[model samples]
Target: MNATCEPRSPRAVRISSSPAELAGLGTLLKCVQAGVGDVPALLALAKDVGDTAPRPGAGRTALLWEILASVTAVDVAAGRILEPHLDAAAILAQAGGAAAADFASDRVSDRVPDSVPFEGAWGVFAAEAPGLTLEAGDAAGRTVLNGSKPWCSIAAQLDHAVLTARLAGGGRAAFAVNLHAAGVSFADPKWTSLGLREVPSGTVHFEAVPAIPLGGAGWYYQRPGFAWGGIGVAACWLGGAVAVARSYQGALQKAADGGREPDQLALAHLGEIDRTLAALIQYFARTAARIDAGELSGPGAWSEALRVRGGAAAAVERIQTLVSQNLGPGPLAFDPRYAKRMADLSLYIRQHHGMRDDAQLGALTFKGGHPW
Candidate 1:
């Protein structure tokens, strides 16, 4: 149990009225503002919040999205790292068992830090690559993980991870494992990307690593919370897009301050971005409301999540284009923060799956009788 990875009680903080500040993010905003922006700090914040970030379909889903968006707006990389930790919490809660109970109880008590089951920083490593597969099987009457998992973002830094592994019966089962345990080793972080460089993601190999099975075979993806978690990622994308839009606005303001009047083309682009983002926000709110009302669950959740993610991803691309074309090469070439945001967002949104996801949504819509 590393002292730095221990979750602590959240402190009270003040908010500022700066024009750039996203005051509407509410309590979550204060948490982000008070913390030092780093992996350990983000993990501490995740554990401190514990089951507080309104689980999708449990109600207050809009507020949950706002919190995710606000974090990304402050820093896209932080948003990338935090969203999954929050999602992992939601999944554990939904999976309800001894581990989940222990996690819930440990958060409020003075128990030994990081010694409890399912405490500290956590990640969900479900991504699979070609020729790479993790398997779970019995060994000495206990289930253990073997093989490797890919795209495990900042895995070496986390204390625990909830991942999926193929069972002997030809299906996948979810399991939670301590990353610090023996037989858990990470590959050399060969990440060379400009975006999310702070979060080096790579492969982790397991040699009979002991684990706690989360749910029965196929339960991880079959649960409604899975779709809800996908929607949460879209929320992060929306937040990143908002930050880019703000950068463009800031550039425009600077130009005006220098006695240059706003041009029609730039204003038109801004108007278009505003319109697109406003509509996307409405869509997210509507989806969240439906999810809470039990209207978007089961099979329906899949398509609704796809729609939200697709729309959010498209909105991000459009915002990026508008900002880049108008601002030219100055921001990417000179402004470090701006450049980092651009690079981070460009890579982050790739998680959306683009047209492939669109195709899945199309199939789902046809199967659902075309609710248009």
Candidate 2:
């Protein structure tokens, strides 16, 4: 995929604490909180000639951009090339929420060297199977693959996919599979889930489909970037938790009517949930800053990312309890908003990478001798 790498604007440059920076991050968070529908429209307008890139301006949108820009700046500070590919994928994922499949479809042709490996894991997990093996043979004048990848995330819509296959050397290699090629098919075409329903998390079957190699065998877990991406996934979980917490606040205001006695038990539960979320957010922010400062490296960075993931997962569970207790039993049946919030929260919480055995191991490695 073609991308232009221009010098980053002043705003893109990493800076120490500043009011302008804080304001920017707040705007980005607010934008994420407001909703995802406005993003395409914003991007479209921002693309016009002679028009400056859209700023968050006065509203929550500005705050959301600031937060995102701050994060991006951190990446820049860490000596990472701030590629549009990474930023675009992150933006699309956030903007589309569970329904990001539509956006993924349009960007299918823009596959990069890294997309295959990243989405390959998603496919394998969706399959919920023991493993996936990628194979290559001559087909349609090119190398082709034969295997199945379930829960390909944007696989149903994307033009190409990065697939993993077992090598003769007893390791795995990621191959890029073209979705539109002959012998490539999607199974269970009409499936949908509660959150990220638009992601088209279905099964993909490759019958000797053409494929391209992504690096060498055993590159998946060997690369530090993969671990870094795991941290980003945790950030997304934190975002979902933020959404749930905000939704709970709105629900609480609506529940308070005519000076009704606030349920003491429910309030206590909500308070605890708030504290948990706050702690997780702080940890995430701190980890991100450390990553920016170059203090976290090697396994230490991965361990910290896992810690954030576990913290986020626990926070989500607590938030769910708060939502259920505060909203009461009747809200689920009567309030579609509450139902949607719960559904979204539940689906987002299932991101399994954070809770994997490796993450647990990382936690143990980091928290040696620490008392709970």
Candidate 3:
């Protein structure tokens, strides 16, 4: 795999002083030592790290800043696969009340068992199909749900899922369902993509399955934490791109061993990749600092999160094009880890709603009040 190009000038890395930084550095060190090898293996490892609460009861953004630090240090699908449950748990904890107790049970970071996945993609597709629906059960604190939930990752592997369903009375609501419940079943994996085959996503059918509502209707996306989670996704993409840059390093080493000079054009492309990734990382740091300080709130949080996601997606796409060109076939064809990272990232970043998100951000931009 390619390595990140070494800087010509020697510079010492700064030591992290804040709790978020310390957590990130510690996680990053662990990942660097073990590193993220297999995509599925990382998720399994996360599941096995039982009872690990991320700074227990810490604010949503603070927890995300720390966890996501390691995510980028590793790779894409590894982070994306594990993020939802952690994000859900933290968000639930911050929301407090019965919702907190529900997720805080064995389902979340409590014992980590295969962890859990938040399945809400259907909410985005509600206009086109029949999404899952929820009905109040005869028993108090219980409800029955039926219909299909799509874009479910690691469907059979996860023991529980947090899904959004249409309430019988009409508005949308989030429900936490135990996958092993009687009426729940996982369909054959329908994902055929080259990237992220490890975390296959498909339709999950629920038939009168019992569920616990998470917050009230519209409570799911109407919080600052939603945008915080988006920033976490961007962090994953940044990590994947970093892995790709590492592959380029291997290419440089190969050339040196062959007594060949580094190609100017390749170096130029590498320069761009380095600059782009550096800027993204710095941006995350600034935002994370704001998050930790409780400064990232109000109407601006989501828009700011949108900008970070858009910028990271754009950087990753640029890196993909540049890396493929500069290194040619060797890395893509021969380097297994690099190849997997690139492929996984390619699919993982699609989680960012392409032109639609860009358009939304543009509209926000045109309104002209957003800070530069």
Candidate 4:
């Protein structure tokens, strides 16, 4: 029963099909791969998917995550841009009430009035900063977002955003704001990172920028869809890990084809990567099913989301370590796709709150009816 003595997948074992294929997103995957490095094309693809992809908590939640995973596997940056956009759409769909009303005013004639069936690229900007703050206030008659929001990714390029802002009366609420409307501007900070270089997250400033409230005070985090959206981000992380693992798989295949047999350590790393990824994949499937079945519609979903996000972050780090320790710097220096994925994933996974999230999950366990 020695762990080190366990058999591993044969060197000839081909890279398995991803969930996207099984979920019938094969054609979409092909289109994404074809549009790989083009930001505009990728944004268009994201919009198309947001318009067409199934909403979370729907019966096809698994397929939705599969689509997200498939997009990330092809290109991490694209997936980075795509995820929040899709999540924004899904949030609006979940908020179906006065929040779903036509937010587009006289200034913006092109945007989708309904917003649930999104017509343009969207991003979520909810991250808080020390001094920077966005506030929802009434300017004479209409609701307007004033102040600034940090970590607004692709803010200049996105057509709209689902962002959180402090209310004048003292509470946080989610709003659908048109990025192109008057008084909306991006700080356009200097982004020096190589990973996700195309997707720069800068400060977005709103000066009486019109916004339509999506949900009631505290509803953004209070809703179950919030947890679902967080898990969807984890799906992207899982896909990025899959893309990195493929690099390792390709190296093994190349070595074998060139008559250089993989050593035991290499095989062991391969086994570890496969097993870890398999567990994460199954976790996603089960979580998706529960969401679709309405089993995780309450506070329980917070723990579930934290578990997947934490587990995925750890799995990604482990896979990255295994690949880097074994393959050395050749791929890092020479392989653009592989190198970009590594750097992008390293940044993307940081969205997980790390040990703070772990602590939250631990505290949740003390509460009765925890996910044990």
Q: List the residue pairs that clash in candidate 1.
A: none
lDDT of 2 by residue, 153-205 (tens): 54554444445666555766655455666777777747566554434466677
lDDT of 3 by residue, 276-337 (tens): 87788778767777776777766677888998999889998999898887766766676666
TM-score for each model: 0.88, 0.64, 0.80, 0.90
Model 4, CA-based lDDT: 0.81
Q: What's the true lDDT of residue 196 in model 3?
A: 78
| Model 4 stretches astray by more than 4 angstroms | 1-23, 104-118
TM-score of 1: 0.88
Tell me the tens digit of each residue's lDDT in model 4 across 156-179.
988889999998788899998878
**Candidate 1 lDDT, tens digit per residue, 46-126?**
776555667767877877777778778767887888888888888887887665665445552333222336578889999
What lDDT does model 1 reach?
Answer: 0.79
Best by lDDT: 4
Ranking by TM-score: 4, 1, 3, 2
Query: Highest TM-score, which number?
Result: 4
Q: How many backbone clashes does candidate 1 have?
A: 0
Residue pairs that clash (backbone atoms under 3 angstroms), model 3: 1-247, 2-246, 2-247, 2-248, 2-249, 2-250, 3-246, 3-249, 3-250
Judge candidate 4 at residue 46 and give its lDDT.
90
Q: How many backbone clashes does candidate 4 have?
A: 0
What's the best-to-worst order under lDDT? 4, 1, 3, 2
